[model samples]
Target: MAATAVPTPPLLQISSTQPEPGSLVVEVDGEVDAASAPELSVALEPVWAAVSTRVVLDLSRVTFLGTAGLAELLRAADRADAAGVALRLVGGTRCVDRAIEVAGLAGRLPLSPDLGHAMHR
Candidate 1:
């Protein structure tokens, strides 16, 4: 009998909330590498599309962050701008916050320290 390879757990998991109509908060948890970027985009596209007020990307639970993850955020920012919807990202974990800080995207990505702050801004 051949030994079969076991599949790895999903690198990313996305959960979402809507505090109000046209407002969304999608929470990301897990690793976000080049491998998981596509899935991240797919998960975000609809939320971005449906938002009329704002979209808050809550990244408190994310365990890892990569350049690909940053790119996805940038794209989401662009989409939100084009659609006239506000986009804000809330920093949760230290590692994820550090990644965005190191990438110099804090200014450009509209990042906040918490969910309440992100929603109001």
Candidate 2:
């Protein structure tokens, strides 16, 4: 008997929107590994260029986050700082939070518990 090959699903999905005049929100779902980290970086390109006062990255739906993903996040922070844009990370899953925490970046990154808090802060 021959074994059947299983198909792999896409690693990530990213979407962006302007929730208000001065805010841009990018919602990310699915896994963010080396294969998908570049996509996240691409999705954030506009964040570095936007004139918005605030940029929010919604990680509430992410299932997994890997080292490359963390690197992209650090890149986002650096770009946001250079652009003078306020970047907020919201609703990260335990997996995502743990990865960041283990990396000892919980304090360096702007993290909020929810969208409302992120928006207000």
Candidate 3:
């Protein structure tokens, strides 16, 4: 008899929302670092291609982040800008918030205190 193979679950979970037209809300929960940024990028590619101008990335549930993750965020922002879309991040933990500030992306990337505020901005 052959042994059964086990399936591996995705490390990141991306949920999409439609608060209004031409807008997309993506909630990501999981570690986003060098090894995982590519996965995150792949998950977001479809959303970016959908013509959603306003993109909100809720990172409240993200427990870990690294330079690669930050770079990925910047890339996403650049893509959004080129597409005439607005990208924002919301609800980060102290560590995650500090990481963004340390990377000198706080001013360049729109970040709000919470998801609600991010959506409004």
Candidate 4:
């Protein structure tokens, strides 16, 4: 008998909108863990490469985030900072919020309770 394989859930989904000049609003959904960190990095590469001065990461739809995800966020932030860009995280759920706080990145990275607030920041 042949064995059936189970499908793995995607690590994350990233979509972007250019609401205005010099900024990119990216919406991220689904889980971000060790298995999906590389994919997430690849997804954000183009946005970073575009030379935007500001990037907003919308995490309202992100349900799960692990250490790998947090590390990826920090790495992205560093790249943005080096490129003279600002990186902000918006609409983080409880788990995301706790993880950021626990990782001691709450202050280093701009964080807002919602997309509206993040965009304004």
Question: Residue 21 deviation, candidate 3, in Å?
Answer: 1.2
List candidate 3 segments past 4 Å from native. 1-10
Better of 3 and 4 by lDDT: 4
lDDT of 2 by residue, 12-118 (tens): 98998888987898999999999999999888886777755989999989999899988998999999889988989995579888889998999877578898898
Task: Please count the clashing residue pairs in each candidate, in the order shown.
Answer: 1, 0, 0, 0
lDDT of 1 at 97: 84
Q: Estimate each model's TM-score.
A: 0.88, 0.89, 0.86, 0.87
Cα error of candidate 1 at position 61, Å: 0.6
Off by over 4 Å in 2: 1-9
Overall lDDT per candidate, in order of appearance: 0.86, 0.87, 0.83, 0.84
Q: Tell me the spans in candidate 4 whose CA falls farther than 4 Å from its real position.
A: 1-9
> Candidate 3: lDDT over CA atoms?
0.83
After TM-score superposition, the amount by which residue 108's alpha carbon in candidate 3 deviates from its true location, in angstroms, is 1.6
Q: What is the lDDT of residue 44 in candidate 2?
A: 84
Better of 2 and 4 by TM-score: 2
- Ten-residue segment with the worst summed lDDT in candidate 1? 43-52
Using TM-score as the measure, which candidate wins?
A: 2
Encode model 3's per-residue lDDT on 3-103: one tens digit a residue: 99999766677788878888888888888888889988997888777865689999888888789999999898888888888888985687678889888
Our tally of clashes for model 2 stands at 0
For candidate 3, give the lDDT of residue 41.
Answer: 92
Residue 73 C-alpha lDDT in model 4? 89
Better of 2 and 4 by lDDT: 2
* Local error of candidate 4 at residue 24 (angstroms): 0.6
